[model samples]
Target: MTQGGEAAQHARDEGDDGDDAPATLPELYAAHRLGLVRLALLLVDDLETAQDVVQDAFAGLHARSRRLLPDPDRALAYLRVSVVNASRSALRRRRTARGYVPPHEPPGDSPEARAVLAEEHREVLDAVRALAPRQREVLVLRYWSGLDEAGIAETLGISRGAVKSTASRALDAVEKALEAKR
Candidate 1:
């Protein structure tokens, strides 16, 4: 067997064989790693940090598999929550560190530079970044991650009503920010 297959078998061996138990971490990682990383990127903005956040999420899931593995859906939910929380923690640490550090200059591009995103896409991303953290999370989870209000509420540990209101307010804020930039 391949290394990943061996790891999956080991993970399965360590966990209970209950009917509700979710797929092994290696299986989930193989299937959803890219999507989880993309989710982290939307939350954290930096590719490296996003990858770390997804890795941390899977590590957290593996650590808690005894409890979380009971229900596959719940395990997936736990992973999503873990990723969001890890991303938040990373962002918080970054903000704290940035306070003590001086800003650096951007890297100079060479002649082989690729094309930048369209202005509209840049504006949308900028507006998303400008939102408050909770508002941003609501928007990204709802729109980008394609979670419904209840799913977002569960992921965010907020009420469904709060998810709706936050999403509404976030959309308004994004629209206003984009308009101001025009």
Candidate 2:
């Protein structure tokens, strides 16, 4: 059979055409886009860049949806991985560009000043931003994204034990940072 025929047959076998059908990419986007953006924001610390990261992740998933169809969970996992990777790329680019750019004065209304986050919340975010990339990713995936250890491990391409330990250490660091601020 042709590949298209095979895919159709697989979809049928999985009962993917009914109400119990797995979500399409658009549906997944509608449901999880904001959460994915929040996940990226936790990594990148810029809302616009975070949105771009999530958009790029969805585009990447759309490009590869043929192989990822029939299982919404797999698509979601692919999206999570894509967002993480894209955020990492953005961070790398930002870091490299920083060396070439002149430092500028802060905006009159910076994000922290413009927003109304609680003191503790702002402190925690500052601490999270100070964490190593891997530790920050672990904390965001574990806490903000509400992923299980296995899910975070799969998203990060790490072991579940690593996810657990990284989350522990990240949380400890956050606590210490907050305490030090007191």
Candidate 3:
């Protein structure tokens, strides 16, 4: 299976269990924060930035009135959008900094983390990271986050048609890149 397939399953597993609907902010955060962090991690390729992105997303939600976000699904969607945008901003800053630490730190920055992702998975991840930003974001959202086109469109603030086209192109690009490695 592909790395994205495993991530999709992982995300599904992280979702709220049935009959235990999140009714409060803390409950909602507990139910979905990790998934959001994983999403950001895929985009930014940095755990520290991913965590900060998630925390900042939650902070934004916390700053708003509860009345503004009463539904768990709505709250989750908001968080997804926030994470995506924040992840983009982090990427931009990283690029602007130029001389900063490179994305390709040779092997096992953390063996515990490396042990979790196989060499094949790491190869797939590096390929994904090499993609254009929008393509990478669409692929991660569609496959890793297990989000449908509408969800991606909403999260990205783009038209549904754009989401459909972007995901199609992104998938083809990923397929070509992976195949080229064969």
Candidate 4:
């Protein structure tokens, strides 16, 4: 097997075996890693810590890859939850570590995709970063990840009503924030 294949197999062996093996970390990472990293940046408000949060979240996901939710939407919800939780953990750890503050460096566009994603992508990224963490998470999951409110609630471990209220508050906050900048 290839190196990636071997790594995936190793990841699987460490997870529960009763369930059909879920998609490999490399596979999931290849598909969603960048987006998740970007989302983490918005949540944690620090580039390096955001990247670390994404990595840690992916590691947790890999450890439980075998027991993923059967529904793809639900699986995505699980991933979002993992990201939020991991980001929070990182934030807490950083707080305890004296004098550690994350730098506010925007992620660079991929050289290959830069020509395609240029200004529009940057605008969206900026908008997302300006949002409060709850709003940002709701926006990223709802719009970016294509998850419904229920899925978002399940992922975030909140009630659907909380999801709706938080998302509404988030939208209002983003709108007002953007309006004030105009």
Estimate the TM-score of every prediction.
Answer: 0.43, 0.45, 0.43, 0.38
Kindly report which residue stretches of model 3 are placed more than 4 angstroms away from their true locations once superposed: 1-19, 99-182
- Residue pairs with colliding backbones in model 2 are none
lDDT of 3 at 141: 93
Residues 8-126, candidate 2, lDDT per residue (tens digit)?
88888986754453467888888889999999999999999999999999998889888885678788898899999999999999999987867797767667855745666788999
Give the better candidate number (2 or 4) by TM-score. Answer: 2
Error of 4 at 179 (Å): 82
Best by TM-score: 2
Q: How well is each residue in 65-124 modelled by candidate 1, as lDDT tens digits?
A: 988765677888988999999999999999898887667979876544533435678889
Which 10 successive residues of model 1 have the least lDDT summed? 110-119
Clashes of each: 1, 0, 0, 0
lDDT of each: 0.86, 0.88, 0.85, 0.77
Better of 2 and 4 by lDDT: 2
- Cα deviation at 67, candidate 2, in Å, is 1.1
